[model samples]
Target: MSTTALPDIRAARDERVVGALALALAASLVVQNAAVAWAAAPSYAAPMTEVLAFHAEHRGAVAIAVGLEALNLPLLLGFLAGLRGLVEQRGGAGAVWSRLALAAGAVLSAAFGLYAVLWIGTVLVADGLTGPTPLLELVWQLHAAAFAFVLSALGTTLVAAALTTHAGRLTAPWQRWLGLVGGGLMLAAGAASLPIADGSSLLFVGMPGYAAWLVWLLATGVRLVRRAA
Candidate 1:
């Protein structure tokens, strides 16, 4: 290929990466939501025993959902790489914001990955465990704490990405607004979880925030796919 053709090939490859990342993220969201909702898994607010019982009975479904979520880890990394390249191409504050988004996404992905593993561990032992529900409760609290950090990082990633895209005229005005709102909601959810011991605190806004994020992921994925096409 000629020198001129190389850039086109590179650009196409990058677009494909973004498209692939979008699909992975969308699939992860769908599977995670379906597994939890269909299995009727207990929320963190539920009693320890209730939560344990649900998991004990529906371990297979829970595992499948979380497995799908785990599949997003690599896709998230790909997204960061694609965003970084876009930022470098655009230059200016877009560059800085993209770095921020990349950093935030990296840590967010790690945190979420760990959160999934932790839940898997808890579910595995839920059925055969003896007394001392407090022990498991403490473990659950720690899991929620990790999730809070994860959400906070996700919020930062979304906001920075939105700013970068908007500045570069890469996305629609409404999409940018959605990013801002979605980011704020995720941040609020993280904040609501400050009292780690009281999972009920997350009921107010935290859950809704994550639900919005799920929607955002789906929409963002579709947009990326269309852009690639």
Candidate 2:
């Protein structure tokens, strides 16, 4: 290969790697959600007795979910770093947005870490108790709050990433619009975090937003991989 052709080869390799990272991140998220669903953990509004019983009886399931959540944090960071590199290399506009995405993704990962830790703590404490305790309830509530914060951070990351890619002409208009709408809903839900942690119905608003984000990740990953090929 000519020396001049080296850059193209390297760029293609970068795209493939980044695309794989995105796909891996998306898959981790899917598996985490499935584990959570399988656990069937009680809602924040559940009675303390019920919450305590569920945690104690289903410790293994919840533990699996927490483990998957822990795995997701690094995957998320890796995806964010790779995506930011791609945006910067494309070198058109939205560099600021790319930076915002990285910042928000960092926050998201931190929130996820805290959330996982809280869940683990809940399971441990609940298992050792015969009945519901104030401390256990508090920990569970904090976990809910942490999850709300994660949604907020995730919304910001999605919006910034969508804008960055769109500005660089790397994604379609529909993806941008979806991100804007979905992110807006997530932000709205997160803004009501206090109420949500107290068991407000507002938490449901972020569900569709989260789903939209997953779709965006899958589509973006496929697009990048195909382009590289």
Candidate 3:
């Protein structure tokens, strides 16, 4: 094979690997959400007694969800890193945005890890106790606050990644718009973290935004894989 052919082969491999990472990240997210939904976890606003009871009764389900989340964090980081590489390889025009995406994704992953730990801690404490304790409630509230931060970080990552990919001509215009809208909503909700942690319903605004991000991820992954093929 000619020397020039090696670069082409490497580029194709990178595309496929990045595409697979995106797909896997999206799938992991879907599984995490499904597990959470199956767990029927209570909202932050639920009464302490009810929250404790739910945790006590659904420890296994909650554990499963947290475990899936732990798996998700690394997938998210891998996808972000791969995405940055893709953008850089495409002439590095969007290097700034790619760097921002990677940084935000790192923070998002860390925040999510904290949230998962807090959640599991609450479950463990609740499981051993017959009633809700002040400490358990405090831990749960901290978990909610961590999730609020995660939303903001996710918003940053989505917007930056969208911009980077679009600037690199790696994604469609519609996908960029979707990311902007979704990221905007998530930022809005996350800006009200204090209220959200206090059990405000305003957090609902971020839910659809998160869904949009997921759709964008899945679409982008498919597009990359097809192009590589």
Candidate 4:
């Protein structure tokens, strides 16, 4: 007698596996944020020269930060995949948002990658690139601008995904609300970053937005693990 074909290995559902991946995504993001903190990236108030000096002195650390961020992109993509799959199952008007969220997530990640590349270049050439190179300044400004654009897209993703998932009881009440707030903050930060890429006070809004994202990611990851358990 012929044996039945084994279930498709790739298609197999293992709650723990998915849950762990989700948690890993959260941890990766935490580390990425921490790397930025470790680098002590200069704020808008600091003169560009000081910023350049700081990066020059901390080239090694900045490189490490870039590596850490590069790692986060894959982790984030995986997490978003899980989320998109879950939300897709709950077909409705809200489901449309899930689709949008998936697209937006891709765009957001790409924007971040661009920022990482430019930052690495800026740090690596700090020694050779002399004072007030307009090209360098332009790249720096564009990187910030790209982040602003992507952050708004990210906010759209989060908001849409949160609304869709809540409809299907994928998230708790508080988490759902928190996700909305987080999304709103991200959108606001993006708007602020759009016109104020010069590293001004308004860019500080992105800090809270970034914090909100961390909180949501951790909370969502924990909830997934709990539910899977």
Which candidate tops TM-score?
3
Distance from true position, residue 154, model 4, in Å? 2.1
Which predicted model would earn the best lDDT?
Answer: 3
Q: Which ten residues in a row have the lowest lDDT in candidate 2?
A: 83-92
| Sequence-dependent TM-score of model 1 | 0.87
Which regions of candidate 3 are displaced past 4 Å? none
TM-score of each: 0.87, 0.95, 0.96, 0.85
Candidates sorted by lDDT, best first: 3, 2, 1, 4
lDDT of 3: 0.88
lDDT of 2 by residue, 119-168 (tens): 88888888878888889989988988988998899999999989988887
lDDT of 1 by residue, 48-163 (tens): 87877777789888788778766777777777678678656545547877888888888888888878877876776676876437657776766777778777888888888787
What lDDT is reached at residue 203 by model 4?
A: 62
Give the TM-score (vs. native) of candidate 4.
Answer: 0.85
Report backbone clashes per prediction: 0, 0, 0, 0
User: After superposing candidate 2, which stretches have Cα over 4 Å from the reference?
Assistant: none
Q: Ten residues in a row with the worst lDDT in model 1?
A: 196-205
Off by over 4 Å in 4: 1-15, 88-94
Model 1: lDDT of residue 145:
75
Candidate 1 or 2, higher lDDT?
2
lDDT of 4 at 34: 74
